[model samples]
Target: MDLLTYIFFAFLFIHIFKHIFNILTQKNHPPSPFAVPIIGHLHLLKPPLHKTLTSLSHHHGPVLHLKLGLRNALVLSSPSAIEEFFNTNDIVFANRPHALAGLHLGYNYTSLPWTPYGHHWRTLKRVTTINIFSSHSLSLSSRIRNEEIKHLVERLNVGFDESRAFKKLDLKSVFLELMFNVMMRFSTGKRFFEVGMDGDEKKRLIDTLTKILVPNTKMGLGDFFPLLTWFKFLKLDQKLIDLHKKRDDFLQSLINKHRNHDPSISTNDTTLMGTLLSLQKSEPEYYTEDILKGIISMMFTAGTDTTALTMEWAMSLLLNHPEVMAKAREEIDSKLQRKNILEESDLANLPYLTCIVNEALRLYPPGPLLVPHASSAECTVGGYRVPKGTIVMGNAWAIHRDPRLWEDPTEFRPERFAAGGEGHLGHGGYKFVPFGVGRRGCPGAGMAVRVAGLGLGALIQGFEWERVGGELVDMSEGSGSPTMSKLRPLEAMYRPRSL
Candidate 1:
């Protein structure tokens, strides 16, 4: 045999021998089902990946060690597993996996979500915590949130010329428009879609966002096998390059406009982009134009779909169960005096409404697996040794629906949260991690709750809603790369209430 053939045989033999030795000797490893050579357990992965992982967790255990290509993943489902990782190993597990999305959309692993846990990530987190997501910041934007919801109500009213007659409305589109308007107005000081805009322009913008977001949200093959990037078979690499150009170009325009913006402009007119631009002056080295764009892009992509989809699911669930809807409306009407709207400040007093929002969050979390966290060093979880650089994914969907943790796990019982002192706070511990529980958990959660509460409360208070054709709204979860949304766009009949 040739020298090359001899070396290949020796390498293969050593690889198989190590596998056999690890299986026989490494009892500290977490239980895993059989994995194939080279590809490992990648073949077992299916769409709506959380469900497949949950099934594996169910059969083997909550803490599972699986080989996903060359990478090792620790699948966590139970709250204990979550705590052990997020608490004991929080720092070590704070790093993110080397995702393809991070390479392109996350500004080369520098965005808040994909940035490694270090000084750089710390700075981004500080900006979000102190400047963006602070209670003061949310209060500052309350006017924008209220105004956008009112605009939505107006558009909904205009759609139905007849006062009391139900009109067929594509709620998915309505919610999307409202969310996009609110998100854009709050972040960029402009609206991508509004009345009197060129129809073609609006369509083009929507199509571009979809083209970027739809694929970014889904886990690409390039993520699992980097070698596939060499071949032109998947085309993910080319697609990402094209998308990054379009996205960066668009975001750059926003930054440039704000750079030359008037300083005397009111804070109400000043947006997240403007605020960041102002900060850039003080910390030019830290807050580069690229960082500014990354923050806004992350805000737009992360904030828009998640907020809109959560509201859509909440409404769908309420339509499927009307008694819960009546209870929520009554709670609002009794305490609320703002005509047909619920103020952002008013969200706290209405406990039942908050419960419904929390329930929806638990049932259909925007991100089922949350984001994949990686270990910077070796760690022990659930009495098993996990290697360094393991990708840790917390299955929020499974944990939220785990029967052991929650009573009637599959049932939509918001009262359970109310019965305890939880009341949408997700209780005292990690029992409910709708927005996830960790240092890297979603920072926009507080703002998200306010948006959902005000938007949903206004709809319930001002209108009468029912499923079209007197049928129930479908609650089947749709497969998404980023968020598990409803399989179908929500369509419902609505009419103005005789308030």
Candidate 2:
């Protein structure tokens, strides 16, 4: 044969051999629905992503795979599958996916929540656990929580009548302000939402944060399709850049204020920023300005809204089931006999109150789909191979409400979490993971539980809560956000309870 003919035949032989090799070596992947060209399963995605994934899992299997544009995704709605992945392959899947929000808002993925699992992440976790979320630290900060809860109670009590008439109030705003104030004080020893604070300053701070946070909750097209990032028409990346600039400026101002302040000024060293600043003086190489700002950003972005929304959901559930509310209040009243005010210490003794919180969390977890985790190495999950860089997300909402897992799963029964209840598992337990599970689980779970417990318990103890206008508070969930929020903000009528 001539040289040209030989080259063509050789190329054909190589191609055929390669195709056969691929067939032989292909890994066993999980079940997936039909995917289209280029877009893959993107067309299948709908709003309220958790519910969509749950339906897909039901149609497919618990371990369902999808090609989200260029990315590979695994959505697990089964507790057994979740346990297998998170337990057996915890460290392999500890890294976070590279998204637009992590690039900008997460300080280019160096922040605690976005950074890959490594020495830096370990160091960040240690610092936060020791100085912020440790039991000892939470105990030391109890007074701040107590004071903030008191402020919230006082603010809600304003404009009350002698007859204790029920007054309409927006509990969403109340809970948001309370959480922000609590987290801000923990970080900076300042309360931005308190009454008589500079109105313009509060507005600017809140506006800037709201602008940044709302976008972070969304998953942009660029996150799934990197090529789409080249088109400026998308504008999500540009918006994130602008928002991060504003956020950086605000955080820098706070750091500078703390940095330049006199050390003798009332022992500010106890504050989170102050503690980090002190560490900066000693370990300047490790704790850079970006690190400080990143930690602070994590404090607000990770800690605030989830706890706030949990409170809102808990209250909405309580309003819909006044019997549950009465039971919770009765437990608090009987436990704290004549104390009137619900204290942080009082929360430990309130088992029924704890059950109520657990039930609320089960019904509507803050992160219905826990934060996305990425696999760093190839691994097997549920007998299927999960390639490196595959994004795995546990549908906590589905697991929490799985009919197979709980009796009357849809019902808001707090007693289901009492002794021998299915929902009574401890943290890191796959069957009941509101705060996530395994190595990368939230270190601040203790603090979150305390703040949420104290806030909800106080509200139940101090108020005669009722649905506004005889209509049930809407229990619908919001869409396009990472955290599950109420579609309609919760508003209720309340009067001071007569103990």
Candidate 3:
């Protein structure tokens, strides 16, 4: 045979051997749909991504795998599968994926949410849990929360006549401002939205914050195709860089202002920043400026919109179901025992109100898909091999709405969470994961529940709410947001209830 024939035969033999080896050694991967070249299954991902993912899961089963461009993803939509992953493989899946947002917006992945699971992450978690969200810290902060709720109620009472006519109010803005103020007070001992405040500064601050928090649903192309990032065709990185600079500058200004103030003489020393600065004095190594700013930013970015969105959603649900609203109000009124205002401490006794908030969280979680987790090492989940570095996401929204999990799952029945109901919030086994589950569950769950409960109970006690124009408040979820916000800003008619 000639040299060409020999070479061809050799190549054929190698190819055959390789194919046989692959067949013998290939790992058992989860089910996946047809993937096209280059883009993989990215085309299947549409706006309101949770819903889109749910549809895919329905067709492919709960433990579905997909190739997202150059990345691999494992999506779990069933309680049993989700329980297996988080419970059995929690450590293996504790790391977060290196998304572009984490790089630019997360202080280069050092922020609490984006940091890898390790000592630094553990330290950050400890600080936040002990200093900010602990029962002791929350108890200390109760006065701040109560004062803010009072301001919110008083603001809502403005311009009301004795007749108590319903007034049209933009509840989205109302809830947002209340939460921002509450968080701001916790962080800096300042309220940005008080009446008679400097309008220009308030507008400027709100504009900056709104721009910073605006959801950019357009995933950067580089995130999927790393090589394309070098070209920078879309300028997503540049935009994020600019926004980060704006955020950093603003936070640094707060630090400097507090630094210049004498905490010994200033009443503002009780703020979260002041406490951190004091800690910095004692433990400079751990409480660096970036750490302080990261905590503050986490509190604002993670805490504010989500808590506010929960309140707005709860209110919208209450408006749509007046019976539920009335029941909640009755619970609050009876619990208060002639006291007109709802306090944070009162929330514990108002189980039905708590149920209402939990139900709202169930129907529309702030994060429909919990923060994505990346596997640190290969692990078995649902008896399928999830390779190392594969991105894992649990579709909490789908699980929450799964008819198999709850009867009349789509209905607005807070009673499902009441005593003798299917389950209570935070107690159900992986079935109720609005705040996620396992090692990486949100540390701020306690604070979030308190804020939501207080705000919802206050509104229910203070207002006789009605749908505007005799039409239902739009309950449609907004697209392109990291949080599940209403597509239409919630508008409703509310008048002070004559207590």
Worst 10-residue lDDT window for candidate 3 reads 482-491
Of 1 and 2, the candidate ranking higher by lDDT: 2
TM-score of 1: 0.88
**Residue-level error in angstroms, candidate 2, position 491:** 22
Which parts of model 2 are misplaced by more than 4 Å? 1-25, 197-208, 230-236, 262-267, 426-429, 479-499
lDDT for model 2, on a 0 to 1 scale? 0.80
| Model 1 C-alpha lDDT per residue in residues 228-283, reported as the tens digit of each score | 56656448677777888888997787676666663322234367876787788889
Give the per-residue lDDT digits (tens) of candidate 2, residues 30-95.
Answer: 999987655679999897889999999999998999988667899989888888888888899899
Q: Show where candidate 1 strays beyond 4 Å.
A: 1-27, 198-204, 213-215, 227-236, 260-269, 337-340, 419-426, 479-499
Please report, in order, the local distance difference test score of every candidate based on alpha carbons: 0.77, 0.80, 0.80
Candidate 3 overall Cα lDDT vs. reference? 0.80
Clashes (N, CA, C under 3 Å) per candidate: 3, 0, 0
Q: lDDT by residue for model 3 over 1-499, one digit each (tens)? A: 9755764566456546644663587688888898765567999999789999999999999999987766789899998887888778788888999888888778888889889999999988888888898889999999999999988787767666655656676666677788888887888887768676554675576656767664452456667766546556557478778888888897887788788873422336678988888889999987788888888888888888799889888888888898998888778767785465788999889999989889999999999999888999877776788778889899999999999988899898988898788866436577889988878888899999998999988877876777776677678898322222221211232344322
Clashing pairs in 3: none
